[model samples]
Target: MSAPTATARRSRTRWFALGAVAVAGAAFVAISVSGIGDNLVYYWGPKELRAAGDKAVGATIRLGGQVAPGSIKPGDGVSNLEFDVTDGTALVHVVATGVPPQLFRDRIGVVVEGTMTRGGTFEGHRLLVSHDNKYRAPADKNVDIKTLMRSTAGLEER
Candidate 1:
């Protein structure tokens, strides 16, 4: 076969470039769409999670609920904490490995992320606390306005 002419060489180069672009685009689409539906993290409250029963096991999920009052307790390790999360209709015991936030308290809203074990307990790796967006002043009527003003008078810039 004779050496390819400049025009023929350019045509082959153009076709190769198009083929490379097509392969890259296909790879990108396949990666972006692969099993994302199956890999999605489930968000479930205690009730819904418990209702799901066997299907809940081994599934990565975010469980949101109130920290059941009087349920917070230390576990085997100093960093390990155990508590029951309740949605008022059901409860899921969570054994987590991490220092819970200082704001963690009874009846406070919390969300734990992890998977449910076959033993029906949630093995959490992360915890988050929900907090109010606005702050409200304490309601105290016993403070004398004159005394309060006098106490704060020294704090004002001279």
Candidate 2:
């Protein structure tokens, strides 16, 4: 073919490159869309999660709330841990076999990532605790407000 019709060859090469890019882009989009359905993440409170009926099984989700006080129980054997997560109104049982975070404790905000079991328990593979905001104070009505005000006087307004 030699060097004949240089402009025609250049135009053909450009079209081929453009077509290849378009095909690759389309394939990427298709794969992404298909994978998204399996990766859908839903956040639900403890009570709301229990109300999800049978549809909760086989679906991955995040249980967001505090671990219920006095509801934490270590597994009977050596490999599992069971606990109840509560959002004040409702509580759901959580069964996890993996090692949980060190900060996991009662009355602390936590988000457990895992799939729900058919027996109405969440099996967490990962436990994420929201440890940034934790304040402990007695709920007595007789607490001295004057001392609290004095202690916070030097702090900047947040």
* Predicted structure with the largest TM-score when compared to the true one: 1
Model 1 C-alpha lDDT per residue in residues 1-158, reported as the tens digit of each score: 45568779889999999999999999888778887634553457788889889998997888877778789998877566999988666899999888788878777767789999999999999988765333334686665543332211111111
Using all chains and alpha carbons, the TM-scores for the candidates as numbered come to 0.59, 0.55
Candidate 1 lowest-lDDT run of ten = 149-158
lDDT of residue 50 for candidate 1: 90
TM-score of 2: 0.55
Query: What tens-digit string does per-residue lDDT give for candidate 2 at 1-158?
Result: 55768878999999999999999999999778878634554457777688887877887788877677778888866346878877667888888767677877766667888888888778887777765322447896665643332211111121
| Residue 2 CA displacement from its true place in model 1, Å | 61
Top candidate on lDDT is 1
Candidate 1 C-alpha error for residue 4, in Å: 56
